[model samples]
Target: MNSSRHYVIDFDSTFTQVEALDVLGEISLENQPDKDERLQELKSLTDRGMGGELALRESLSLRLDLLKANKNHLAPLIDVLKGKISTSFVRNEAFFEENSDHIYIVSNGFKEFIVPIVKELGIKEENVFANTFVFDDEGKIIGFDKENVLSSNNGKVEQLKALDLKGDVYVIGDGYTDYEIKAAGLANKFYAFTENIERDKVTEKADHITPSLDEFLYVHKMNKAISYPKNRIKVLLLENVHPDALQIMKNEGYNVSLQTGAMDEDELAEQIKDVSVLGIRSKTQLTKKVLDNANRLIAVGAFCIGTNQIDLEECLKKGIAVFNAPYSNTRSVVELAIGEIILLMRNLPDKIAKMHEGNWDKSASHSYEVRGKKLGIVGYGNIGAQLSVMAESIGFDVYYYDLVEKLALGNATKCNSLKELLQTVDIVSLHVDGRKENKNLIGEKQFKEMKDGVIFLNLSRGHVVDIEALKNNINSGKVNGAGIDVFPSEPKTNKENFESSLKGLPNVILTPHIGGSTEEAQENIGNFVPGKIIEYINTGSTTNSVNFPNLQLPILENAHRLIHIHHNKPGIIAHINRVLAANDINIVGQHLKTNETIGYVITDIDKAYNIEVVKELKEIKDTIKFRILY
Candidate 1:
């Protein structure tokens, strides 16, 4: 708190998020037939006045005449303005309360509206310099006080000179008149406040363009609630993950942008150059080249279930945490598996095709019920386990096999090996993951081991099963009917055509990969994945991170939290503590977790410290990434 430094802030579009006169016009002209036209005029006049195109006196006169607002409108207008305070200002309320003596509300607006709003923030009423609204005998608006210097052109500069604010005056505002104070040599610096609005003419003349009040406080090393503002963290969400995800990130105050579809490797690499957080579905690939170009990336969120499209090993080496929705869409994929099994078992694809061609083949030639069928589920993961229980309830004897041992659910039985499950079941549904070892796990040899005329389904990864072998098996009648939702090759967008060997086969149900594509499943995923990423970012909690060690961090309070990700080697944690000890940084609490390749350590220390400590910590050997969470 530097007592010599004075802060002069504007009211409309700077302290509050809206123009005052425009709101007043809406309130007073509510019953008027020409309310829309009057509101438009009020907005236009405000822009011209703020742009320095119109005199302040003339602007105020015309706006008041247009408003025709009585004393009653001022009270309601104050309530609305209170709620409309700039988000950044609301976050730093403590700073304003502590520095009330040095902070002033200097605007060309009215004191009746400005004082009430600033009063709640601990601003002194005498420090507020603005015009006074004169009223008639009936309490209707008539005019303003002409004697006040704020009602004239260049009023802010004239008013500041009269007050003679001492030492290093800083002006934060969105209008050209606010910039006039600095231009007239009354203020030291002019910051163009753009949290609510950005005027080109005003920002072009500013010494600094502050996106939020937090940015200004951060630069000045003031005692603020946040060490780093969320508005500085750039989040790029691609493939149109979900609207809920977008809203969630925005509510967290991040600079979030959304792209409708996934980008190719080259396009993604360029777009990720400066992005701090990247969100995508399965279509976007996070290759080595793309990750290498991401100079500022901190986390990658796989909004879908599988992380096969991302290079997990590379992400680990780069100290980037990766997350995915492992169980959010499980029920959706399981329900789709059951529906597809019934459709393929009844040979409905061929029958439905014939019906479309006007051939009324009302014959149950090969249609069979699935009540007593054996349903074999490969890879007993979330989707697999859920499918097992659901299939058992549908009167099918469920059998499952996985590389790792898993407990059987309900009356379902676990197979000892893949060969054993293939030989026994009538319907084989692949619910495996996207590991490289699982690619082409089912080829011609495995298909041959399955019972003849068996039904097959692959709703998992595209490359898990050899498509050519499955196509030959279906054609030879060894597989009576099949449902293949995934393939080795697919189109990136819906506008492109898809071609596969399984297509045009008799009794084969070839669907585009849409196993988990339900409105409910998408919404569930939208609610879960972004929330996890937000948790990891806000509290350094990596409980469900795929590529990082799991640590369920508690919320940080009354201290600064520092996170360091480095190569997993001996003496890394010891060296970090040594550096902190040398800088006199008292560690309040500390947590360390490590994997085979990377070590993550979070340290909480006293809030008071030098910024130079960060540079020393980064200079340590084997350091990958470092960040401060305050």
Candidate 2:
């Protein structure tokens, strides 16, 4: 390993968990009703495995055109981004105090979003290298620096070569650009971080595959600069995750294993015998029994959005943190929704079917324009909220219904009840959560309340609506056309055959739950989700944590520290301090926080503590688990 000590990290899918550009586009074009088609196309290209640089170029151009996105649009986008910062970002003030000089963010993504995030991480503006955006006199976003080397293909390697840093250059990221640093021989070591997207090419080329930055520091003996092989993480790639994910884990020096095809609970348990990190998609059913057998499983990777496949409660009981791709596929799902809305209004599905059967039937009277239509949205979370603004921009009078309060955007109106929204809107879309109570939420009664010939879309969850009821509603002419993406009982693997109840209906659109299946979204997903997982495992940071104690801190240097996980009770901190005081260890710095059930404390001490302090700290009545970081 080259001993020169500087590190470079990617932004999109590498630092932030989602593509900020895509999120900005969705938020900015809330008033444009005509750019939906282009948005869909952009999302598709990204999901199909387009490189981040290319995906950003196409998507950014399309969004900027639709948005005329200027400075005014940027403030709201910044708010959205600030609220959605990465979970692994070093937020500890002390950690930043120690390591700020060595960390750098090198990205092809826009400087607008990157600057704020880096500033939050305590990295100075001078430490960040990114593409700059240009706005016209009208304040409309025009273009980026085409001449900037970082924006070009292989730009990361070129940028690093120009840096001429003293120490070994260590690159961490989830894209081909980051991998190119290693491939080009500019960096001494490249870490393939799968916490975001796992590219086969990048993983195959990486020197190490790290799930998180914490893992990287731990492996290098850097955090506290101590070496211990027992702390080495062993990862198991179960069914459903891409092969690239496994390769990256192996490259990272993890004792990695892979199990192909589906397995029953017993087989799954047997396979995870020694696994510490379990990676899976929707296929693998991580039941309580399976989890009970996994003595060493510390984490679960639900590679997809919906976590219904995994037993979250069971995992939590075992202290296993779970991570999923929530916003990674937002653009893909929104694009598909927009396409379906246009298709359904135009009666394109039926027209295409007739044409394919060699029937030349031309009827414009039955087709209507998407513009000037009423669009009703249910469960205004990430996907629903995004679709709302996009639909409104396309001239659709947007009405949304959510159980919880949501901030209104553009011309979108909020209906207090689902019934009220259904009766008033021409198109009804489901984007609710995957809660059990949501099953059959939009069955016959809700459909009956909808205006006759109303368009319907279900891009959320299969269980959110009754498929049989939806099919019946279409037959009775209560609904004009429908787009159904997700299903209640989808086949786990790509190889498995899928059967659906809403198979053959006139003017009905059936997609393979591909609302988020665009190449852009998938690559973002592959690049983003794994990065979050990796960051969490590496840094003990959990800004986007679905479970476990949430601790945010600045990056820590080579100071010996004790991380204590305990029951969130009163006096836990005092007791921890007492133990340290009794051991006579000097406390250089300390930070403490608590979630629902657990309290986490990171105490930086002078690098000469006896092992007895750790032993005594673990014996505290409230302490759940403890580890030393040195």
For candidate 2, write residues 145-223 as lDDT tens digits: 8787776667777788788777777888877778777778777888987655667867887888876555676666553
- Each candidate structure's TM-score, on Cα atoms with residue i matched to residue i, is 0.89, 0.63
Clashes of each: 0, 46
Per-residue accuracy of model 1 over 89-131 as CA lDDT, tens digit each: 9878888998999999998899999999988788999889888
Ten contiguous residues minimizing lDDT sum, candidate 1: 606-615
Q: Model 1 scores what on Cα lDDT?
A: 0.91
Q: Candidate 1: where are CA atoms >4 Å away?
A: 1-5, 18-84, 94-101, 135-143, 164-169, 179-189, 198-208, 219-223
**TM-score (C-alpha) between model 2 and the true structure:** 0.63
lDDT for every model?
Answer: 0.91, 0.74
